[model samples]
Target: MQEYAVIVAGGSGSRMKSDIPKQFHTVNGLPVIMHTIRAFRNYSADLHIILVLPEIQFLFWENLCDTYQFKERYQLVSGGSTRFHSVKNGLSSIDAVEGYVAVHDGVRPVISKEVIAASFFTAAEFGSAVASVPLKESIRSIDPNLGNRALDRTHFRLVQTPQTFRLPWMLDAFSVDYQEHFTDCASVLEEKGYPIQLIDGAYENIKITTPEDLKWAETYLAL
Candidate 1:
């Protein structure tokens, strides 16, 4: 089956306290988004890449690619005000009616090739799949009116992306009434009663959002 990767790079790095978007920030002298694109490309050279970026940052992304000699031919989609809307915009650019489509965060460049392939194969077999890592730290639930309370960690899974789904199923999910609660594409499907199979996700596949994350990314690249 055909496959595609949608890299969502629309977020502003407000938490990073930088004027540039986090995805545009450099790690080992390459943009974080470029590293993310390369990870997918390394996994599957034939996979079509669709990059979703904010309207204001479109020129910057293009210029960055040109300056760096990034060779992939990725279709650019103008992102919306929210992550869900940004994904919808990217989904609209794809003409594929069948096969698997994986939506990944552009700032998460450390996702291993194994996880990428695993998620794709799982989605191809099960129709929908999400990459997730089990919580290692102690779990807790906090009452808004009271203080924090320890809870069971068995029920919790830290979801990461490269969330894969059948193209038709994802399209249908987006057509429904949108909500702010839809944090990821999988959530959108879950709202529509679609069962999402989970695969092991790497803890290293962290999205760079803060200065600390950027620093960590640089150190990661150094390894």
Candidate 2:
């Protein structure tokens, strides 16, 4: 079955204290988004890519692609006000009926090829599959006023990406009207009564949001 990746790159760098968007920021001399696109491309050269960019930054990304000679077969879609909306817009750009779609964060450049292939394979077999990693630290629920609250760690799992789904199933989920609470594609599906399965995701698949994250990403590249 055909596999397509919808890479969402609509985050602003407000937390990073930068005027530029986080995806455009440099990670070891290459743009963060470039690395992400490259990662998927490396895994499957024939895999189709669809990029979702914030309206204001669309021209910037286009120009960067040209300047860096990063030519690949892909389509660009305008992002929305929120991450959920952005993903929805990207999903709309895809016309494939069969196969699978892997929705991923554009800033997460370190996702391994093995994880990408495995996630796609699982999603193709199962109806839906999400990449996740086990929590490494002690779990705690903290309240601003109450301090720490007891919570079960066994019941929780850290969700990562690329969250893979059958194209038809995902398109059906996105067909519903948008809501403020729709945080991710998986949440949208869950609200529609679809069961999501979890797959092992690499801890190194971190999304770069802040300046500190960029620094650590640079260090990660050195190792």
Candidate 3:
């Protein structure tokens, strides 16, 4: 069986308040996306990486790769109008009959190799592995009739990426009509009656969406 990672990145830097896309932004002397790719590459040299980016950003990404001398190999695919569609496009490029694929956010550049390994191992054993973390702060829900009220934080987990699944399940799940509620790979798989096996994920696996996140990733890398 083979291993694959579909890295989806479509940041436009609206949150980061930059003219440059967040994925192309530099962190610790390397592009954020490069750190993300290296995280998985360090996990397994044989892991086949599938990079999903907007069609317009292909040349820009390539130029970054060249300027940085990024030698890691990855198959590039054009993203769709939405993140859901972008992920589906990435998954559709895989031709493997039997294997596991981990869908990850390319802006999350600090995912540990341990978590990446555990995702594949758990997915192979249980057919699905969705990385998540327990929340530390109190939370609440808001509605017109119900209004805001405190809820038990222990009952919920903050879902993170490398939402891994069997290759066949991934291909089949994305084949359905794109639903508005399909927020991530886990949602699509859950809709198809698959159990979501939650695994511990590091808080350091934060998505890089703002300047603070960039600074945090830089600090983490330096440590």
TM-score of each: 0.96, 0.93, 0.98
User: Which candidate would rank higher by lDDT, 1 or 2?
Assistant: 1
TM-score, structure 2 vs. true? 0.93
Q: After superposition, how far is residue 12 of candidate 3 from its true place, in Å?
A: 1.0
Model 1 regions more than 4 Å off: 145-147
lDDT of 1 by residue, 55-108 (tens): 888788779989999987678889988888888998899887887899999999
Worst 10 residues of 3 by lDDT: 89-98
Q: Per-residue lDDT for 1-223 in model 2, tens only?
A: 8899999998887998988999999888789998899889999988999988888887788889888888867888999888888888887887768879999999998888899999899887788889988887678888999899767777878999899999998889988888888878889999999889899998877878878888878887657
lDDT to native, each model: 0.89, 0.87, 0.93
Off by over 4 Å in 3: none
Arrange candidates, best TM-score first.
3, 1, 2
User: 48-86, model 3: which lDDT tens digit per residue?
Assistant: 999999999999988888899999988999999988899
Specify the highest-TM-score model's number. 3
Give the Å shift of residue 50 in candidate 3. 0.3
What 10-residue stretch in candidate 1 is worst by lDDT? 214-223
What overall lDDT, based on C-alpha atoms, would model 1 receive against the true structure? 0.89
Q: Please identify which of the two predictions, 1 or 3, would achieve the higher lDDT against the true structure.
A: 3
